[model samples]
Target chain A: MDNHELFIQGSRVPDRGPDGDLMTLNMGPQHPSTHGVLRLELLTDGEEVASIRPHIGYLHRCFEKHCEKLTPPQIVPYTDRMDYLASMNNNLGFAVACERMLGLQVPEKVEYLRVVVAELNRIASHLVAIGTCGLDLGALTPYFFCFRDREMILDFFEEICGARLLYNYIWVGGLSHDFPEGMDDKILRFCDYFEARIDNELNPLLSFNKIFIGRNAGIGVVSAEQAWAFGLSGPSLRGSGVAFDLRRDDPYSIYDRFQWKVCVGEGLVGQLGDSWDRYWVKVLEMKESLSIIRQALAARPKDGDVREAVPGRVKLPVGELYCRTETPRGELGYYIVSGGGNLPERVKVRAPAFSNLCIIDEISRGALISDVVAILGSLDIVLGEIDR
Target chain B: MEFAELLGHIRAALPGAVLEEHPEAFSPWILVARAQLPALALLLRDDPALDFAQLMCLSGTHLPASASESDRLASIFHLFSPRHRHKLGVKVVLDSADPACPSVAGVWPTADWHEREAYDLLGIVYEGHPDLRRILCPDDWEGHPLRKDYVTPATYNGMPLD
Candidate 1:
């Protein structure tokens, strides 16, 4: 298939064509671009990959098994480990589900703090995604620039929450600690610096670079029907021209209060819903997250006890709840069932990476071996989140 | 639609499919008969009024033997319709001794992985699953670990738990 034909139409080459001369190549349990211990079995015809099967669970900690033993409050730490890149968003999702089970709502300050930290983490996570994607496709400098900005976000996180990587800061009912002195100004400064940095620093380095766009645009195309049928969410779903953001549609937390646009791929430089569109959506989402952070900072209450309504003891009613929030990667859902006890009966996590990664075999059928790396990088699957 | 209105719509379309409805629960849900699940799932997706374009999550829950009933395993499918922006929770209860439910992987592409995960963790055998191998756990792992009566093995493949 020609590049022009493939760009207009999604990859649909035969599974075992080209005289049936196929060779199998195993990709990674430790390869650099596989992201985190994910292994792929590739069926290749010459240099093009005809089929791909993903094997995960190298990072399996059986988080749901762990949650079965821990209480609603105690499971917060485990949630952080699922998607370590976006620990605040992970903690916020589990806490929201547990709070719904107990029917608890925190003060307005707590809500604002949650939104601020989560949005900041979204920017940090997307930086890693965009940076590593460039690195995988042979660009070296953008990765360094991406990590440099990410370091500042981590510093802000360390300032607010003692732990840098896994905060465990967001509790079931409220935050573990309120914002410390002078925290608002520091976050706003970082936000101001990042808003300008994206266009000047990121766009030229990777976003609009000729080689980068050539490698990504129209490589792994996912149609709108295929996107939602396969349960793709977050940026992956939006990349296919689907404007479904849970924060906007479902109205969770304080997201409805904010005024921000959902970034959908417009085929600006390539065919809509291609790998470039997916990568571009993450870049645009970083700016939207900054807008949210600034709005949340101004609207937040100056004086309020974040921990005033923190649950002292645990008592779950005999019922179940399924709550989902739009995490940086996608929709992170928690289906918690309580049998009138302190501990949960069942806790099933619907990790977005698991579903997003499942669509790999579908899109990578006709892609070349080199294109596979860019495709996987576009999907941005975290093995920890997938295997959990 | 409100929970009751949706429930009524479902009941009218597919009579004798729903076994129970809980509007008072934290998230209103309807218990569907095990045999009717495949049809019910297809209807939920194809029906324009109940256009559930996405199967958000499919979870397996093991309920141990209680005074009310014996050990039962339930497969819960959370459906979301982007068109209507409505949510529905459909559950199917199975016997823990022989937990088997027809797979809906053909209906919703996402169910392919989810059914495997549920089967791996809870041993809920999906009848028509294309590939039902263990997902998170090893293929030869002796028993389902999520069961209430699960006993962790001391060693596996000569590797000690310690």
Candidate 2:
């Protein structure tokens, strides 16, 4: 068969042969299962996929170009737009990178508050991951259930930052606002309520369903070696049983102080690196995030100025820093280069979804077309992050 | 192994390959010649004493317009050795007149898209890349947008832009 034809058409079927059964299909850019504007070019030999190419850039906003012109503090809002689901985590990553560049030490209360909101955002982000994976697998009930819990987190975020999806709440040195009166108690209550509901209601309804397991288990398995080589991070890598979480392995902020377990896939329903394991990893991580939220709430500083270290006009000396934070997806790294100016010389975002999405063509090579969706869903890519 | 010792080992392994060392930078980096990157990457990954197994991030940077052509573009590689729990930064500078460097995608598959992204945004060619197509921008897009001297077009596909 002609490799040239396959590259252009993404099909293995011979162009001149009448008996060839290979077909090429386009999956997204508008499809619901894609979760965003992602187009998957699929080459299928009947039901089994021969090859797949993911076409992105539908959401590219030239964020890096925009950052070069903006001041250090101005870039915080742009970071929020990349991974819209976990804006708090994105803001925190940029904030910490700038803070480290300037050698600014934030207040103790700021660190604890950052962790509290970041972990809360992690739970919200993972809820979307779990809920969408269920929806992609033809189970609709869990999506609503997951969203119901996620809405409560968003409500708390709204109460704190006044925005639901893209809150530019995290400034360079501190937060945009302190937690309002009695907000910590509300977060504590939500944590308690979320833990009970996830354990009692959501787990049995979706995670433990035999149909869900049968659909996801052993589908699109990525070996530990391939996962590392392809730079898979966050839950997808953990699902391969690598036991690497930046929060624990590369301790940043106050995560080292929190008491929580890094959840790795045990292959409960399938091979350790299968799609099911990846999905299950996200499910277990929500519980760990709750545990962290509980601990952070209990030990949070009672009174301190969250913005004490925040300078009115932020400036940086000539220097460079690379800071990686554990986002809901995986390791979100910001490499900032300053040329002794108010604006960064260069800002490069090492988006986890970009690396995670790169592995799609590698693992989806021999799997069936249906398994392609299962694998893509399990990867849990946000196009905002990938395209940015 | 600590970062200094890791650099010491690399320096010993490949003499003259370590061009410059910034030990005091926020993320201490070592500049290597572009031609030596692939070998250095292989050594960093395979050497047990300095097993930088994972390529954490690859960023392409363009020097200011005032800089000469010989120092126009650079690629930064942030590597992490999970076994040692240590990190190192490797930088390779290239001349913009012929901004090309040996591809490390064969050594680390993750570098495939990253190199492509660097090539896409900064016009730095990753020589020997499997398929060096545009990643974030369209295949038919005109100029590298991230370059220091890039000028935005007023129209793309006849769409007006102010």
Number of the predicted model whose DockQ against the real structure is largest:
1
Cα-lDDT of candidate 2: 0.88
Here the TM-score of candidate 2's chain B is 0.95
TM-score per candidate: 0.96, 0.95
Identify the leading candidate in terms of lDDT: 1
Q: What is the Cα-based lDDT of residue B145 in candidate 1?
A: 81
Poorest lDDT segment (10 consecutive residues) of candidate 2 chain A: A1-10
TM-score of candidate 1's A chain against the true A chain:
0.95
lDDT of 2 by residue, A123-226 (tens): 99999999999899899999998999899999999999899999998898888899999998898888888889987988899988877777677778888888
lDDT of each: 0.90, 0.88
Docking band of candidate 2: high
Q: At residue A352, give the lDDT of candidate 1.
A: 94
**Candidate 1 residue pairs that clash:** none
